[model samples]
Target: MNEQLTPRQLMILVAYFIIGTTILVVPSALAAEAKQSAWILQLAGTGSGLMLIALYVQVFKRNANSNLFQINERLFGRWIGKGISLTIALLVFVFCAQVLYYIGRFVTTQIMPDTPSEAIHVLFIITVVVGMRMGIPSIARTAEIYFPWVLLLFIFFILFIMPDIRVNQLLPAGEFESMSLVRGALQVMSYSFLPMFVTFASLNAAYDWRSSMAKAFVYGTLLSGVMLTVLVMVSTMVLGPDNTTTQLYPTYVVARKINVGNFLQRVEVIVAFLWFILIFIKLILYFDVVIMGIAETFRITKHAKTLTVPVGLLIAIFSAVVYPDYVYQQEWDNTTWVAVALLIGLAYPIALLFLSLFRKRKAAAK
Candidate 1:
């Protein structure tokens, strides 16, 4: 039985995945370099991301019925394609660990200070693994089910926080250093856009991959990008660039400032809840990518579900060691992660698409 995801489900998944880790820390990441003009950098990054999606659309058009692993095998041939697929699986697995760590660290630091991050990692991955076992349709349906609540909470978040948005805080905008803006934009793409390459792993499951899928990808990305830009601008406006850069999760801190009539107080939980949903969806999606890639590469579909728990355990363990300290994670994010994301998310797809075109031309010539 083939599982099918609707275009709407795909759109929601893409938006939630792109907004995953980005909405929480993007303010600080952008403000650190772009300063008062971080929102502008976000807009730039979003634009760049949209353009990159065009390239993915081309690749998808070439093999609308094949998942990423199958495409790799088709384009690169059996041995080389399987090797590349395995590498992708390994890389995504590492990223999955990092995201798990992010969730664990966030909960322990902001909400449950005394709780062990490892504990959170284990618990969270257990849930994600369960989702994986249910398959893509179930996962997408779950996202659809939660979409309206997430939207409602987001509206409330913005409405309440509007009063605290001081125009003076963004006064020094447009005075950004060019290199700083470039760096900030790259950071945003690394976290939000580049990682979207993972979506290709599931696009084949979409009911309308050729037409509606492209529209879904474009719209979903635009929605998330706008949402992220708003969050960054609001954070900078309310928290100031200095404070925004200093805090680990600036958007969460901004949520603390939302108070309506002093009656609706202590609503930072809204931000936490939002982050939890986005992060979980993103994490599970990445986990699915890892599973599908490995299963396809190794011809282990029969045992994929049974291996889910062990893979989840490995992710939980790796989350502890992905970075020794928070400082190291930040450093890696600013430097190493951008390069890694570009290599897999940008270079890999472009190479695949070009090779595919060449192969088609050769066949046509024959």
Candidate 2:
């Protein structure tokens, strides 16, 4: 299928992918680990993420006309490439499932305790399926429309709560160790940027090649990193490290503190609404990339129409199966799981760039 989407549409997709479930939980999660120094971790993650983008851009440039599966086949021969593609596809599918489940569980617990998580899962799957069926351009256009409102709500809530910020709460009073900071940076990097590896696989299908993608990746990562930094800083400055660690959603807690003149309380609803929109866009973008990957792998014509419902359903079911409960998932994410993500998102791409360079040299010699 040669259905081409516009650069604007692709940019929207990229933006949505860059700011999804991570934004909702990462600030509080990383704050628990790194305390007031969490912003440093976020900054480090953004710098490292840019390096990963460079590697992805190299791969995309080298195989500009091919999807990831095709590129792998060309680079590593048919069988090895198929194995690599299958492994990547499976990993991405698992990641998508986890994202869906996390969002569903979060909405049920935080917003509507009476509503079952399964219902939220179904609703989310339906929306994703509809968006995927509509095609990438439609999904991208929808993201562009919703993104501004989400950003406005985010900015307004952040501004409204600024008066409550207590700067002393973030004072680096405790003894700091460089090793601990490095570990914290690694953890935060895993949480923030590692999941984005799934999207790079489909970059060949994206329009405008290097400039558009490089711009989107750089600006979007910076934008998200800045927002997340502000969120962590505000949480630290308002709640203190101990209270920030105890709270499930410290950013939401900060929003709850937004009581301008005693009339502006209960702003958490606005925060929750924005979270829903941002996460929904993120999930849809991931769904789009996974669908495209499947199509390219199988060389299917009109893959979008045929795969949308099935993939969405699979994600819903897989989401429930991925973790026994939210606590287990949280533990997994904090420790070994996130480390694995960093390896794939950062380490693997860098390795690929080196491998590609070696291949090019050998071909030139011949």
Candidate 3:
């Protein structure tokens, strides 16, 4: 908890942040819009991500000595900064709850159909709450340790599923409405790229002097983008865009297809577990960010852990009631979540960067 994140840790954190729930849900999300062109449209998201990485890295480099709290206060003044911080915290809290919902919904529907969603939700939230209460370094370290296993499993999954990809499935990229393609790209960016922007407020993962956070973030985004592109391609090829779109968890469905001479069958559960691990990492990171934000807003300098249990309790109950089912979740993800993510992730950072630059020039002119 007391340790600072290294370059490697920062890169891993960003990768996991982007990968979070994006991998689990992206196939269906993209298929709904772009269909067979889901692969190409996802690559478009990398462009959006590169643009965001540049803006956020500038923020990170300029405010190396300050956390997001101090940077916001310095840039926007106290009242506005507090308001901004509260918004960021709320987003983080909601995101945490969403991630938990993903775990519960996945487990209940796929693995443990008879198990109560509330039971799964409580068990999962407890893990994240404990890890988060430890501190930023703890969260970063957890990412560092598990990232390799995730990378290996993901790559192996892609390889094992390679023989299943059909070239014809990804064809007909030109037929879709360009607006639909554009919308698909936006959804990809919202899921993959914008997370990079939101996490700037979680700069509690605060980089050490030896590492360049901007460079680490660029590397991480590129790697995660590549992974996402491959996943989209694979999903479209193996499952066909139609199947991918219809299945609620297409990636998990795709994973169920792994079989090499029947020796490596039923390994889809491994992929499912990996997704759960990724969700845990995601939820914990957001949980820590919200707690830190609240403490900063109220000037709770010490013993912030006191707030953890109650907040965790709130998150648990909230997750249970957020959406009655996955349909409502899908609706929110498609509509309201976009505006929320863009406001906090895109608009806020860009505005802050402009203000910081303007203020610097004003000071210089003075």
TM-score of each: 0.97, 0.92, 0.95
Q: Of 2 and 3, which scores higher on TM-score?
A: 3
Whole-model lDDT values for every prediction: 0.86, 0.73, 0.81
Per-prediction RMSD in angstroms? 1.3, 2.2, 1.7
Q: Which ten residues in a row are the worst by lDDT in model 2?
A: 1-10
- Runs in model 2 deviating more than 4 A are 1-12, 173-175
How many angstroms is residue 1 displaced in model 1 relative to the true structure, after the best TM-score fit? 9.0
Model 2 CA lDDT for position 134: 79
- Tens digits of per-residue lDDT for model 1 on 1-366? 127678898899989998999887688988988778899999999998998889888887787777888888888999999998889889999999999989998999999999999999999999998888987788888999999989989889999999999989998779888898788878888998887886555446444664588899899999898889888888999999899999989988888988899898899998799889999999988988888888888888767777788889899999999988999998898889999999987998899889989999999999
Highest lDDT, which number? 1
Q: Of the pair 2 and 3, which is ahead by lDDT?
A: 3
In terms of lDDT, which candidate is stronger, 1 or 2?
A: 1
| Highest TM-score model number | 1
lDDT of 3 by residue, 1-366 (tens): 335678888888788878889988888888888789887778887777788878887776666667677678789999898888878887788887888888898899999999998899999888877887777777777788898899899999999998898999988775678888778878877887776565655563367655576688888888888888888888889999899999888888899999998798889999987887777877787787778778878879477688888889999999987877877998998999888778877888888788888888999999
